[model samples]
Target: MYNSDTTSWQEVLAAFKRIWGYDDFRPPQGEIIRSLLEKHDALIVMPTGGGKSICFQLPALLQNGLTLVISPLVALMENQVQELRDRKLPAALLHSELPTWERKKNLQNLEKLRLLYLSPETLLSAPVWEKLCQPQLEINGLILDEAHCLVQWGETFRPAYRRLGAVRPALLKSKPAGTKIAIAAFTATADPKARATIQKVLQLQKPAAFQISPYRQNLHLKVQTIWTPRGRRQGMLKFIQARPHEAGLVYVRTRRDSEELTELLRQKGYATAAYHAGLSPEERRQIEASWLGGKMPFVVCTCAFGMGINKPDVRWVIHYHSPLLLSEYVQEVGRAGRDGKPAEALTLVSEATGWLNPEDKQRREFFAGKMRSQYQEAQAIASKLPTQGEVATVAKQFRDGAIALSLLHSAGQLEWQSPFHYIRHQSGKSCSFGELNAQQQQFQTQMTQYLTTRECRWQFLLQAFGFAKEAAGWRCGHCDNCN
Candidate 1:
């Protein structure tokens, strides 16, 4: 009943009103939707709460074909799919944790779906890929939500993401003639480098690019230096006590920190929970539900707590420890003040020198050390990788082989042949050392600058994120520095 022809704008409005109880689209959202409906490729870089989901979801609902959204986190996919199903919309998700019968049922109903959300790894799995490539399946588009993960994790951690560039072409080979699969990538925080990487990797064709600056005027930012670990605990407790009824999140860098902070908060008579990747999916779900449902006022979580979880009225976010990357900081803080109300973000760090507590510096060095070791492993395996083969078999054949292969791909010595295969360059050279290390150090330096800068917090962020014109003489009077 919905179509994207010239007159489809009216249809879009009608659907929006009927389904979402809304009257309009955000800036560039209508334009982005129009482009995708016309089978045009697009790259969208709007920040969080900019209605990024609606831009893709609405178009998918209006089309006859299916839109595959490759997202990073399981929680994210489930949250979105559940929301759509509540609206009686045709959206479903597939992930590792789904029950066998449910997975089978979803697959059997694939053709009935307007949107299907999955991880890049799940998308390229044998059964999933086989079904999607069926000559009868009509995939209208491939979208990368949280597209920055393709840069953040694809290179070293999750190699399947590195092969996504080859997905569209492979799917089209089995599709009927006159079928055009428009490709689009959506992300909340992609720097110029990340944007270029996403475009180059996904091979988007002259996409309609929509970029919104990563500046949130509603979020008040501040950084507090604590001289001792005990002081850090006190600061956290104090921050929580001051906002007794407000819901918020405390971002930490480790699982242990998440749990310890959770205990500290609980002992202070606050309802809180710990969240990290190590928890069972069910446990994670309960915690997510508690916080989202307002049974818990806050959560102490690692980076795993992000992507696809939506709560508009979060009044604050405190970085229990400094993030090692500025992009990460922006993303976590963007989660707050999404309802257009005032929100606070307080980042706690150690004193200028590491004498009192070198925890932050120690963490940065440890992270760098891990990257350096991965580089060494990749270099050792580059000349030894099979000329061409499936990544799963390679992973079984050698230790950390998949990770090594991904590192080599990111270093330019290897290229993806398909979603599950690769071709090593016969240049007779191993992956050169220090490239990944150097990149890691550069990111660390940028994050350090953000933490130590004397400029207005938002101004520093705007300038760092490539909106120099807007950052020029821009200062929010509410930031800690200004106050």
Candidate 2:
């Protein structure tokens, strides 16, 4: 292992230049890297384009053993791994999408790997977990990329992340004595509550946290409330027409919306395609490649479109429908103007009234009720679950049972043995169903308020994400409200 205490900053700088060709480190990149090299866990909450990747990537290269990056998306993992491989760095990824031969090859080459990326789901799978637990393997660090997903999706969409808190201890049991592996989580948008959730979920110990303000002066924020479906479509068309051939992305809430809007734009002579999770991996990759290579001018997509995509010249982003959460809104819009040039983001919301748009309120209420039911269901099942059992075993007995286990883990009623297994820590303990429900309602209300606010959009976002001090006495003249 590299003795970070004895290593000089000159060596670090040299490695940085050799790998990334950057003459100097960004503001907190150096500090964040040092924290990891010294084996201190960290949580980084820099805005998009703030050079978050380098903080972990650079240190991984400088370290001896492998760095395991737990990312949420397969595309994101493949993108980063491919970039590293292109640079002749030792990087590989493991995911279910890989062909049989490719998966075998990656597993065989694990010992030669410097950085390995995998989704939380894949990392927790039996095959991968067994390989990682082998005593001969040495892991330098674990990185949770796009860490806010742990907070956003842990309870519902992906429960494997909730069990990650147990990973360190379980892995330690198999490793040689005194083997220490540091952990670091990186994200573009995590408020105070989300940060706390990440720390608890990942078992980060007194982690050195680095958070930058989410404000971007170059990205103008705007919201328009359309009273009818036709009006919304027309408004979107007008917005797209105003931009012409510039590269941009149109975000919709569902696959149906993506398909419908793509056809509408195609009929209007726009070079575009629809992208959603419903497409096969090859199809998604083709669309992504075409968009990235400039063959396609724009894409009408669901939220699955742009996580780790580094398109600097994207001039605009339009939300055909308002996102359910402010975090989603901030992340989706932050994709534009990454090159620090002027860009625009506009969200089309439904006008709140009986006749024109009942779907918006109905959707919000449906989601809120779904969340409440999930919490209630989790509480009900907590008593019936075994003290120690595999996740798959318990999941077979109930619908969305993985989510139930995750909620119990979060509320301290259970503990994970690994991603796929858990141990009941406290039987018959009441999980904080009411508290979680209230928090969910608050988050929904905040998004609704953001759509209706007449104040500076950026200011509203900063305040919403727990940056009250920064939002105070500040106004960006670029936003619609400020203008």
Candidate 3:
């Protein structure tokens, strides 16, 4: 199974070793790599440290045309592009960070590149679409990294990923029919519904799906129920104090919480830094580098952080807030113990907040009500607006409620400038009642189950994602719940 002979897969692995200094492929790497090279759409859900980049990077080198990787993080894109270039691979990143002239130069060099990394936000832009529509632009494959965010892991909505279906059409418009572009979606977390959402959003043609389990035996999974704010803070402080100089991550629910917690940790004489989306791109990059390079052992960040984080020695992952869902909880915990060593996964659930809150209940109810309102708004706007400007004006008012617009648009209740912008009428002027009811029911079911489940957290998690439990190694002896 682990072949070293000169087959196409072996040849690719050999080049991989030569470029990245690795002698063997990780388990499932060989299978996924071969599938990608054969020009097939693949949905891969591997845990952290599972060698996801090589699955697409190696294929990019061996393919005839440039490979396009759609990522969600600017820092991640730049880091990946830089890492490839360090190894002398023909790679570049296309993100807003580059100046106009620099971006033009990068695009000009596209004909010579093997891999081009782009933020999904940038890739969904109209100007980018114009370039992709060019007759000369050649993309052999599309690799969507952290693809689960496109569906489940995203907040109330993910507008950028909602536009991926249109991206394929735009790319296909310029390329030859025989080119055969392969699409690959990779993530560390995705439930069954999320997987289905990805397939529908991308319009993949019966894509092959592979999911490795999230349970890591080496990581001790722990949950501590803390009722008081001061008690939770003290518990976190004590945990960090116990570890001293070890690396760790603290994931809070909001940006403000990340900052406050980081400051508290620092005041208590620990090396800590705050990280969240609110930080400048440069500042975020600096904080990430400091942690990754071992300059700091503790970084308090929001759930928005860690999309593409690759630090292998994160000794602990502590959650200050109850994650919106268990899938998110598992992925956040997976970040620790990546170095094949003992690590800690701790969630300090505030008993007052409990598993379900009135606010959460209201938020879900509000989302449902707003979805209906936005659908009607889109329908009304579509009837009146013929030009793009009128459609855009109305869409802007509803931008904060984009999820409502997106679901309506997907359900054939309205149209938009693109999947990302503008509004238009459904071609049929009618709704698919069956489809609408089904999606609404499905999303609601997931939301309810995630909040109410009483099973072993790990078992519930694996089953939600359609992954089978392996031989038992999940009961870490140190977890508070275990004792």
Candidate 4:
């Protein structure tokens, strides 16, 4: 085992310089690294482009055993693994997209791997989980990259993340006595409630929490409320035209929107492309490469475009449709000003009218209603579910059954046996379905207020995310309100 006492901070610094070519650690990075090296679990919340990956990557190298990094996006996993490999580090990634031969080779040589990056889905797969549980395979830590996705997508889209709380205990059962693996979660956008959800879902044990203010001084935030689709289009065109030669991103709400906007922009003689999850992997990679290589001036994309991208010169980001939640808005806007140069973020919200262009209000109400229905559906299906069953089995049995089970788990009504299997818990009082609906409505209301408020945009965000102390007396001269 590697001894933290013998490995001094100077040694860590030297390694960081030699590997990452960084002369010094940014603000809280050194502290986080030290905590990990000392075998302490951590919850790190930093803004986008804030060296989060390096914090865990460096320690994984300094540690004795393999570090399993759980990531949500396949592109992100590939990007990190490729970068590590480019540096001649022993790193590999396992995902569904991998070629058969490469996947077979990596699985066969698990012992030689130092850093293993894989999605939550692949991590809990039978073959991979079986290999990881072996007594001989030593795992030093588990890093949850982009941890907010645990709260954002855990219940609805990716049910695997909801079961991660049980992973540590289950893995411990297979290891020899006295084996402890530290877990650290890293995210660019997670508010206080989201942070609590991450801690509870991960079952973090007295973790060392680190949070940097989400405020970016160089980012100029603005919101434009429009009464017509044409007005929104014209507003976006004007914004893009003003920054003609610069690189920026225009975010739309749906894939259809992305395609339509891309076509519209092209017709108006702008160089842009549509990016969303529906495209093939090769198509997505090509578009991403074009954007990063400065070939594409701008991309009209959905929310899938900017998770692991590290373009330092993103001059601005325009949201054609307001994001459903404030956390998502913060993350999308956080993509700008990475190089600390002045950047702009403009969000266009549809005006709430009785009949003409009421899309935004209708969308919010639709989502609120959908959330309520889902909660009711979950409660209705909970009793009929087997006491012990696999997530895939339950999903196959009923529509959105996986999500239902995940909601129950989040409400402390069920316990996961593994990622796939779960055992229902019996409590005197069942979960409050009404509470879930109320929370959904509350989130919708907050977003609505943000769109319509005349207050400082930055202040509103800080307050919404439970940073009221910081928001209290602060006036950002860069935001639309202050300007």
Candidate 5:
């Protein structure tokens, strides 16, 4: 390992310039890179243009073996891998989009590479884990990208992520003795609880958590209340007209909202595009590229558009509707002002829909029902596992039991009898009148304050998430209420 402190900032600069030809580090980048080199577990909360990638990528280059990056988005992994390879850095990604031959070849090349990115979903697969654990491939470090998702915001019951704790132990068991693996978890949004969850879920050992304030002095946050849907359209138009030709993002609550707003903005003479999960992958990428490349001055999108997005110089970010949670609100707005220049965040809030968007509401219901059914099926399967061979019995019984328990526990439909045992839904524990409702109501109250309060949005958010606020009250000055 390089003696990080003994290595002057000049040596780091020369090495970076020699490889990527950069003369200096972005603000905070040097501190983070130094932390990584010193073998400390770091929790990095860097906004879009805070130079997050270089913080990790540079360390990967300086390190001896492969750095395993656990990314959630397929496109994100592909983009990073391509960029690294372009820089002549040895990098590869294992994702579902890869063909069989390519995936196998990438796995074979793991020993020769400096970085390997894999989605948590792919890493959770038993077959993939088996192959990766074979004597040849030993990970030197682990990076969890979009690390906040390991908590409930991105994963309400993401089974794959829950399994990662066990996977880490399994990985450690297979690696050679004296192998010291460093893990760093990075995200754009993580409140105190989410940060804790990320550390626990990733099984980090006394991780050093570093959080840059989400407040950007360059971005203004505004919330305007509209009484009707028709009023929202007029509000959006007015907001867009206020600043023409500057790049911006408009976030809507639904896919249909994205399509309609895109058309509305175009009719108003602004170059625009719509993006959401409902669109085909190709279509989404095209829209994203258009917006990022400055071909379109604005993009009407769902919350899915901003994760790991590197587009800088976004002049504004407008939320056409309210988000369900405060964490999400922080993430969407953080996308702007990432270039360290002034930007704006305008949220057009209407009277709450009571969560009535058919698609959003139905998807939650559908997933809940599916989890219940899967739980029952897995329970039956586990009961039938024979007490015979160690590997087969343990795999069949332990996995099924773990899955059944985690799903039910997360869904709030089961009460723990012991660590290994659980009982069925009691009245208070069921969905109708349970802990779930209590938590949902609490978050709703937080959202209400977010939209209605006269206080600075940054201060409001920090308090809502149980973070310590600065003594000056508002840390950053560019938010709507501050201005």
Candidate 6:
């Protein structure tokens, strides 16, 4: 175990240069890393290109015990773990896709790891959770990578995320005394509301915060209105044609859209592919490798495409359809111009109304309907929920009962005692379809407002992300409306 308390900044730089061959830390990187080494909780938000990973990774290596990184994506975990292992760093990742032998081996070696990456689900799985609860595991910190996912998906499909705030406390309860477990949430995109939610949900204890503005001078933003679906196709094609062989990503809302658009582009003699969660892990990796390797110019994909990808020279990003949230828009577009060169983010929209092209509105309606149905399902099962029980046991007895409990927990109608155990209140607080759908409605409205706003695109994004001071009376003079 390294003596982090007496470690000098010079030694930190030596390790950085020796391992990653870097000489300096980005602005707040040094501060964030210092906070982690000192065992202080922190919330870090740097833009996509800002060396965010080094801030935690290096500190984890300098620490005494294992630093558990809770990430949202399997591909991201695998990519990061592979990179560390390639450097001969004592890092490992555990995911469901691992073969039995590999998984068993990882479990056996958990105590020896310096840094371990796993999804929130994997972290809470019985095998991993039991091992973590062991008094001798000697955990030092918890790192939440791509933390915006906790706020974005915690209340929705990925209920496992909602249970994370309890993780540190619950594990500490069974661990040996004097085990200090600090937590840090790291993300490239998070708004003021999202930040507040993360702080509250994680029970962060006066965490040291570092937030950089999402504004990028080199990334030009644009939004075009198209009256027809074919016009939408044409707009994207024109943008790609203008770029002429530059690496980029075309963002879509669904898997079907990814495939359909990829097919259309490929028919036009473009070297492109569809990327979405529907593809097998091997298939996804192949596409990711091809794109990153520059064999494929660009790929049409859903929001799942860009978390751990370190492609620094992505020249452009086009949104075939507007995302439901501004944070998502910022994250996707932020993927471009990472090399500090000029990049362009173009968004194509249907008319202000859905008269000629109805995809955007249809998607909103579809998503809203689904949210309402989910709320009703949870509402129906609320009364039948037990006061306290294992989440998995309830899942076996009732369909979607685990998810319902999750949603109830989100609404203050129930509580998760631990990732595996939950407790529902007998009476008092009640949840509603309307109450649960409120946040989604707000997100839908914000995206629509962004699509139709006549203001500078960069300014709108900056202001949307709680950078009002930086955005004050500022204009890039290059965005669609600015021009």
The lDDT, on a scale of 0 to 1, for candidate 2 is 0.87
Global lDDT scores for all candidate models = 0.87, 0.87, 0.72, 0.88, 0.71, 0.87
Instruction: Using TM-score as the measure, name the better of candidate 1 and candidate 3.
Output: 1
Q: Choose 2 or 5, whichever is better by lDDT.
A: 2
Could you estimate the TM-score for every candidate? 0.97, 0.96, 0.85, 0.97, 0.82, 0.97
* lDDT by residue (tens digit), candidate 1, 1-483: 455445557778888889999898878888998888888999998888889999999889988879999999999998999999999999999999999999899899999999999998889888899999999988998999999889888878887888888898888889998789999999988888888889978989998889899888788999999988898888988888888889999999999999888887778777888999999889999999999899988889999996778999999999999998898899999889999999999999998788889888788889988888888887787667777787888888878888877777766677787777888774664436576678778988988888888888888888777788998998788788878
Which 10-residue span in candidate 6 carries the lowest summed lDDT?
A: 424-433
Model 3 worst lDDT window (10 residues)? 385-394
Tens-digit lDDT string for candidate 5 (99-189): 8999889877777888889977787565667776775676767788888777653223444665455555566677887666788888877
TM-score of 1: 0.97
**Stretches of candidate 4 exceeding 4 Å from the true structure:** 426-430
Candidate 5's C-alpha runs over 4 A off are 1-10, 153-157, 266-270, 352-433, 465-467, 475-478
- Enumerate clash totals for all models, in the order shown: 0, 0, 3, 0, 1, 0
**lDDT digits (tens) for residues 1-483 of candidate 4:** 347867678888999999989899998999999998887989999989999999999988887778999998887887889899999998999999889999889998888888999988899888899999999998889999999889878876788899888889889889989988999999988889989989988989999999988999999999888878799899998998899788899998889999998998899987779999899889988998999999998899988889878899999999998888888889899989899999999999886663778877777777777788888888888879988888888889999898889888877778877667789877865467677667767776787788888888889988877789999988999999999
lDDT of 4: 0.88
Error of 4 at 329 (Å): 0.5
| Candidate 6 per-residue C-alpha lDDT over 1-483 given as tens digits, one digit per residue, 9 for 90 to 100 | 346667688998898899999888879988998889889999988899788888889988987778999988888888888899999999998888889998899889987889999999999898888998988888999999999998888876788888898898899998888889999999988988899878877889999999999888889898889999999998998889998879999999999999988888889999999999888889999999999999998989999998878899899999999898888998999999999999999998888779888877888889888888888887787677667888888778878777787787777767667667777674566655567788778987888888888888888888888989989998888788888
Q: Report clash pairs, candidate 5.
A: 221-480
What TM-score does candidate 5 get on C-alpha atoms?
0.82
Candidate 5 displacement at residue 258 in angstroms: 1.9
